[model samples]
Target: MTTSPLRRNTLKLSLLTLILMGFVLSGCSGEGESWNGKDISGLMPGLEFELTDGQGRPVTADQFDGKIKLLYFGFTSCPDVCPTTLQKLGQATESLPTEAQDDVLTLFISVDPERDSPERLAAYVDFFGNGIVGLTGKESQLRQLAKRYRTTFGYEEPDENGNYAVSHSSAVYVFDREGKARLLIRPDLGVEEIRQDLIALAKADT
Candidate 1:
């Protein structure tokens, strides 16, 4: 007995749907592949700004023209959030392929320039990893950079012991090769999620 034409067409449609579903699942399952760091393309097409590095050197957005940049704002004295986030970023960078690694830059900018001097900032960043750059400058300059990035930070008064805490935004801003802001990752995100987003932005064609 032969199958009816209607039944045959129904089977064909069902098979096609199954194939499509498989493709979608495969893409989602291999999200890790995007974290390899070579996939950010056209994410942040073009943007430019100037800020100081931990060493007091003038670091401009142009310096990162051909690479993906992870920009974070916090003071050196940040007791918890800053260090934790930076460490996670270090891990994500380590997980990238070498070629992609070379194209990645992580910048830590001090919002409390009154206390976080260039030397102090440099030392703080160096403790994390090699590719991480620390940045601090005049209060005015630092404030300008923070404003451009829409990051806010403030320092609490010191206690009787002359120690205080700095409270600041903990979002990691991802910029494409051209310096445009592409995505923002909060400190609470999983390391894997951060890695995957970075990889996807890196693979973009900007």
Candidate 2:
């Protein structure tokens, strides 16, 4: 009658996703100014993290100040969701006015550091677009960032072929230029909705 590590992690991740999804639903109920994405103005803290970039150099959230950020968590090995989400974000940023496009940035943080090396992350992100940056770090740093955003991730046991699956929140966290949390971009949102939300956030108080 003992729970395995995989089961424990999965349960914790599922619970965390439910809790954060509730916040997203409430934020999207139009409690304040309307936004295409869920308004998460005060649900989480401003962006802050100490991690390694795709180049294997250290980075902090403060280094990205003054640009609107779309922070997402996933792994490069992910067969579907990660690539799709990154592509959607890339498209959303590209749809912005040429001038406004540069104002938005997508930070793709990979939680599966065991397999996602800095070089692999760099190449993976490059396939997306210039507006996106790849990031990862030690498990401890990753956990801190995930915890800060009220999300969690877990890994499934590997099969005989040495392949595994990862469970992670598919939501993207949007922050304004000043690094204040602003919106939760749910996976169900389309490119246009995400684009519009990015435009508003990028142009805010500028």
Predict model 2's lDDT versus the native.
0.88
What would the per-residue lDDT of candidate 1 be over residues 146-187, giving only the tens digit for each residue? 666544455555789887766566667777776766555655
Q: Tell me the whole-model lDDT of each prediction, alpha carbons only.
A: 0.69, 0.88
lDDT of 2 by residue, 153-196 (tens): 88888989988888788889988888999888888999999988
Q: How many angstroms is residue 33 displaced in model 1 relative to the true structure, after the best TM-score fit?
A: 14
- Per-residue lDDT of 199 in model 2: 73
Off by over 4 Å in 2: 1-11, 24-32
lDDT of 1: 0.69
Where does candidate 1 stray beyond 4 Å? 1-47
Please tell me which predicted candidate would have the highest lDDT against the true structure.
Answer: 2
